[model samples]
Target: MSAAVTPRHARHTPGLLRSIYLPRTADALAFAMSTYGIPLLVLATTRSAALTGLAFALEWIPRLAAFGWAGSIVDRRGASVVFHLASLGRALVLAASAVLLRLHPSGTVASVTVMALAAITGVLTEFSYIAVETAGAAAGRRAGRRAHRVQAVLLGIDQTATLAGPTLAAVLLLAGLPPMLAAITVLSLLAALLALRTPPSPIAPARTPKGQTGVGLLTGWRTIRSLPALGWLVTGLTLSNLATGLLQAAGPVIVVKHFGQSTTDVGLVWSAAAGATLLSVTLCRFAIDRLGQWPVGAACAVIASLATLAAAQAPDYLSYLVLVAVLMAAEGGMTVVLRTLRSLVIPPEKFGSTLSATILILLLPFPVAGVLTALTPPDALGHVITACALLQGLGLALAFTRLRTDPALRT
Candidate 1:
């Protein structure tokens, strides 16, 4: 009987994974198309860099703001319900935006319409993101001790979608904005349909802890504060992201000016880096099984820091490209470790809220890096990168030291 049950369990696992991955893939592709295509549309319609910049800001601002409410919704509703609603909402938004664009082909009206579309879609996207993340967390829990493997596979899918999404969007845009919008709408509806097939989450809804009145951002904050090890990890990752952000924001400028490479070469550099990251994420699962999350995480942090420092001082484009690949590779490994630990540690009741809060904190550095890059002279960008890298190394050292002694590790 036990042997029969084992085979049945094995048969069910693939169906479960497939149901989750399919919707995730479609949703991610739609998001990627919108993220890339929208800004381009704005620029092409208005031909003003200022308005284009505002469009970009509009998109991200709503996305960040929506995380709070989105998480709350995910906690109140089930992941499947929230995911379906969000995906369908996104489809409606895109279709409506396309109609609006057709009415107002090009002008201030069109610009405002696009910006509004960006903001609305941004919010909807965040809702779906939180829903999927909650679903993933539930799946991770079901995987027991091999949770990292599940996360690794999901991470790989995301990276692959991110790499492919923009290029696919660019191709669709060649025909016209309407075609691109239609494609996104189709993908979103497909995602909604696929969401119905996913296994229902085994986790319960948000529960107010003792002494807490209700679940909210305050509760999430308290949850993080209650988990010292998780707090340290978040802080360390935040610092590391600053360095990585600086590198990313400065990539185009450095590749073109510092290295005398073409703009197309900039894409090549990042494509290669992303490939390395994909490989690293795949390898991290096996590494964690052998060396454990703690040692693997520590090694990744060290490698990322060292690579960042080397990339800053790299004398030529080829060397810089290699170092960037190495940096991203290590970052990928660290991401798997952090995500696996987050699934294991954060309470199911608080997972959605805490995940949103932590993600918001992590994203804060990217805009700051962009601002710093825009203000500084090209020649001095390398110095800033080096400084951030050093800070990353120090912060990670401190965080890991605390983590090594934390009671959570023993658990």
Candidate 2:
């Protein structure tokens, strides 16, 4: 009876994983397309690095602001409802923006229109993100001791989307803007359709007092405190993102203005980086099983720091591109570590709220990075990248030291 049951259970696992992966893949690809495509559009229209950076800033500000409420909604409403609704909302917004852009092809009006879409979509993206993260965590919990494997698979899916999204978006952009916008809108609606098949949230709705929704965020805060290792990890990752964000926000400017590369080559750089990251994420599953999460995470941190510092002084586009790939590979490894740790440490009932708070904390530097990119001249981006790299190294060192010693972190 036990042996028969084991086989039966194995048969059902893939279906469950698919339920999560399919929708998540669609959603992530659409997001990645918009993320890179929007900045490219802004740069193409305005021909100003400053404006490109500002557009990047606009894209992230509302995302940061929405995390608190997005988390509360996910916790109270359940993941499926939040995920489906947010996906539909994003599709509608993109459709409207696409139509409006056709009317005003190029001008201040077009620029403002895209920027407004960026802000609105940013908020909707957060809601979907929080919902999917909650669902992923629930799946991880079901996997018990093998939860890290689930995280690795999910990270791999995300990297796969990243690998494809930019290249596809750039190709569509070549044909024209409408095609790219239509592609993103279609993917988003597909995500909504797939969301209907996802498993219902295992966490019971977090009961809040009447008009006391603020309690959700407060709980997230308290959960972070209760998990000191989580707090330290989030803090260190936040600092590391400053470097990554600066690199991302300045990528179009650096490639176009500094290296004299075409827009298509810009997409290729990220595609290559995402390929490296996907490989790294795959290797991480085996590495964690053998050497453990902390050791693996620490090694990735070292690699990312060294690679970033080197990239900042790269002598040519080829060397910079290679170094950036290395940096992102390391970043991917770190992400697997972070996600695995989160699933293991956070309490399930509070997972959605805590996840949101932690993501908000981690993303805090993105807007700052955008602002820095805007202010710094294109020629000086290298120096800014170098400075951010040093800070990332220092922060990671302190964070890992604390994490190693923290009683909450199980070996």
TM-score of each: 0.91, 0.82
lDDT of 1 by residue, 1-411 (tens): 122211111112335456667878888888888887788778777888998888888889999888778766666555778889999999998898899889988887888888888788888988898887777766776777887887898788788888888888888878888988899999999999988776543433343233322255666677788888889988999999999999999999999999999999898888888899999998998988887778888899999999999999999999999999999999999888777777778776567777888788889999999999999999999999999999999999988888876655433
TM-score of 1: 0.91
Give the least accurate 10-residue stretch of model 1, judged by summed lDDT: 3-12
The residue ranges of model 1 lying beyond 4 angstroms of the native Cα positions read 1-14, 199-215, 405-411
Model 2 bad stretches (over 4 Å): 1-14, 38-57, 96-116, 176-178, 199-216, 249-268, 373-386, 405-411
Candidate 2, 183-287: lDDT as tens digits: 999999998998887544343334533232334677788889888888898888999999999988888898888889898778677888988999999998899
Tell me, by lDDT, which candidate is best: 1
State the number of backbone clashes in model 1: 0
